[model samples]
Target: MKRQLVEELKSRMKLLQEREKSHTAELSHLEHKVKVLTEEASNRRALVDSLKRRLAVASREKSQQEAACLGLRQDLEKKSQRVEALQARVSASERSQSQLEQTATRQLEGLAQQSSLALDALQGRLTQQSSLALDALQGRLGLATKQLEQLTSFTKALASEVLVEVQEVRSELCRKRKRKRLEEVGDVGLKKSSVSRAQAVAASILNMTPTDLLHMLDTPPDTEEASTEDSRRDQEWLEQVMAILQQQIPAAGRLMEAVRVKMKERKVLTEELAALTAPVSEKA
Candidate 1:
């Protein structure tokens, strides 16, 4: 019985030892699982922190882009207003240009008509004045011819009288010299007197004045008849010249009136031309 009891105790001791060994192995496996779970939790926490940082950066970028877009929209609105104002101003300018063109055209047509009328009036006046001038010139030529003929007749009569007087004086001088009969009379005094007398007669026949005759002859003539007739005839000729000049006065007045009218028409035409050309010149 004592031996059987001792063997039972030994068996119990061996079973307890086996149970302890199995429990130790299960605990080591559980410890390894726990270490693996802790490492997984640490890696997941690092990933979550990285994802939160990315979300914050994305939100900031989105806010900045929205601000920039708002500023761009404001600038576009300002530019659109400026463009609208410029368009309105261009339309107003076009309307004003059209109105001005219409006014200029109407004024130009009226000026053209007035200029034509003025030119026609000027032409008619010029024609009348030209005819009057021609008639006046013809009348003056006829009068000059008549005066020239009268002067020729007067000169011939004076020449004939001068020749007769010169011949008589020469005969008297020859007689006086023959009576003296000294070979040649030292009558250089008488000869000089005769030469002076002949020179004076020649000057009178040439229709020179007394003062002019004295310069030509260097002495006085023996006769006074030629000088007296010359003065009387010159006075009569002057009166006839005055009468002819008076007769031309009315024709000169008519010519002056025609010139004045033409000048007035020209002034009117110049003013009309300035008015007509002003608009076109401004555009140029």
Candidate 2:
């Protein structure tokens, strides 16, 4: 009975030792599981902090973009207003330019019309004056021709009378020269008489008026005795010469007056032509 009891006790001790070993192994496995769970929780917490930082950065960026959009919109509105103002100013300038051009054109046309009328009037006056001047010249020329013919006839008559008187005097002088020696009655007396007659005739012609010469020519030759026939013929010839000289004076004066009037008209025409051309040059 003692041996059996000892065997049973040993068996029971061995069974208790096996149970303790199994419990120790189970405890070690549970501790390893706890360490792995703690490490996974720490990694999850770091991931959540990184996600929060990324979200905050995205919100700040969104706000900045909105502020930039508002400023761009304000700039666009200001630019549009400036464009409209400039367009209005341009339209006003174009209208004013058009009005000024129209006004200038009308004024130029009016000036042209006035100048044309003035030129036409001046041309008509010039033509009328020229015709009247030409008629006056023709009348004066006819009168001069008639006067010249009368002078020619008077000269011829005077020449014939002088010839007749000179022949008579020469015959008387020849007869006296035959009777008396030429040296005894020196040529001094002959010279003195000839000089006296010539001087007296010249003086009479120079002193006579135009009317006196004409009257003398119209009247018949004076009948003189043999002693005074030579003197009377000389006086008649001088009167004819004096009448011719007086008639020419008035003709020369008329011609000079006509030339002066023509010069005045030419000057006026030149001034008018310059006035007409001045505007044309300025426009060019």
Candidate 3:
């Protein structure tokens, strides 16, 4: 019995030793799993710290961008106000320029009116001067015509008086002839004195003595001393000279008529000159 008990105790001791070794191996495997888990948790914590630093930098950049946008808006508003002020100044300058142009136009119109008035007045004065000159010339022409008529009448009367004087001389010569035999010795003296009084009268009237007046109204010759053919011939010659002088009166009348014709032509020219000037004077 002792031997069997001893063998059973030995077998139980061997089995317990085998169990102890298997349990020790399972404990070493659990320790290796805990080390791998610890390393994984430490790597996750490092990645989260890097993500937080990147988020802080992004927030600061966003705030700076917002401040730049506000400054740009304020600058735009100031530029708009300056533009409005410039537009108002331009409107005021345009109004002043318009008023200056209107004033200049009015002054120019007044100056033109004054110049026109001065020109009209000058024309009127020129027309008046022309009219006055024409009237004075007409009056002078009328006076000349009247003088010419008076001279013509005086010449005709003088011609008649010369004829009467010649007839008286002839009659006186006939009477002296009839009384020759009845009178005494004064005949030669009378013949010498025949032209003396007539020459003096002719010098006074004609400013020169004329042969035609030599036989007119001499003192009667003593008929007995002066009766001769030479005396008769001399008396006939004087009568012929008187007749020639009478003929000259007609020639002087013809000269006067020709002068009148020239005066009429001059008058017609003056009238034509006046006609040419009439319209200008009236317009003025």
Candidate 4:
């Protein structure tokens, strides 16, 4: 029985040693699995950190993009306001130009009317003065014709009947009277007919208006030089006024052209801005 007991104890000790070895092997396997799990977790954590970094960079870029977009938007708004102001200025300038044109037209019309009326009055006065002088000349011519007829009759009678000295004295007296009458008639005749007759003849010969000849007669040594010079001066003044008006018109046109160029530039800027922001807007 003691031998049997010792044999059983030996077998149990061998079994216990085998169980201990198995438990040690199982524990080593479990530790290897834990190490593998730790390594995988560390790798996953590193990957997550990398992804977070990427996300942070993307977010920062997005923020910068948003800021840039905001600046662009502000610039666009400013440009839009500027464009509107320019448009308003253009409209105001156009209106002012229109008003100025209307005012100038009215002034020109008024000047023309005044000139016409003044010219008509001057023409009427000249006509009346010419008629009066012509009538006086005609009367003198009639009296001279009568005196010539009487002298001729008296000379014929005296040649036949009077003494030589007496007839010479009578003839000298007749000659003196004739000279005085001629001087009176000649002076009046030249004054009345010189300008009109010369102008009429010149107009007929040159195929021009008598009024143009009349204006030509307005120079030095002509009958109406003083009045014509005044008229010429008036015409020059009117021309200067017209020139001033025309100059102002061109200035307004130039202003309008400048505005048009500015508008074109604004349109170009707007198109470029739209192009620049198109992608941003699409992303938004």
Clashes of each: 0, 0, 2, 0
Candidate 2 on 1-284: residue-level lDDT in tens?
98998999888888877877787777777777777777777777787878788778878887888788888888889988988998898899889989988998999899999999999999999999999999999999999899887965675465455445454544444344332332333444767466446556765878975445534433335422533764564555455444544564435444344434434534554555555446547756
Model 4 lDDT tens row, 19-42: 999989999999999999999999
Candidate 3 TM-score over all chains jointly: 0.24
CA shift of 151, model 4, Å: 81
Q: List the candidate 1 regions with Cα displacement exceeding 4 Å.
A: 1-22, 90-284
TM-score per candidate, chains pooled: 0.29, 0.26, 0.24, 0.30
Highest-scoring model, TM-score? 4
All candidates: CA RMSD (Å): 31.2, 34.2, 40.2, 39.6
Question: What does candidate 1's lDDT look like per residue over 6-114, in tens digits?
Answer: 8998898888888888888888888898889888888888888888898889889889989989988999999899999998998999899899899989999999999
The superposed Cα distance between candidate 3 and the true structure at residue 19, in angstroms, equals 99
Which model is ahead, 1 or 4, in terms of TM-score?
4
Q: Lowest lDDT 10-mer window, candidate 4?
A: 158-167
Best by lDDT: 4
What are the Cα lDDT values of the candidates?
Answer: 0.64, 0.64, 0.60, 0.67
| Clashing residue pairs for model 2 | none
List ranges where model 3 is wrong by over 4 Å: 1-123, 181-284
Q: 1-284, model 3: which lDDT tens digit per residue?
A: 98998899888887887877777777777777777777777777777777777777777777777777777778778877877887788888788878988988898899889979997998899899989988989998899767766765665455445434444554454554434422333444554355456467776797554543433323345533444553564455445444543562436555455445434544654555555446546756
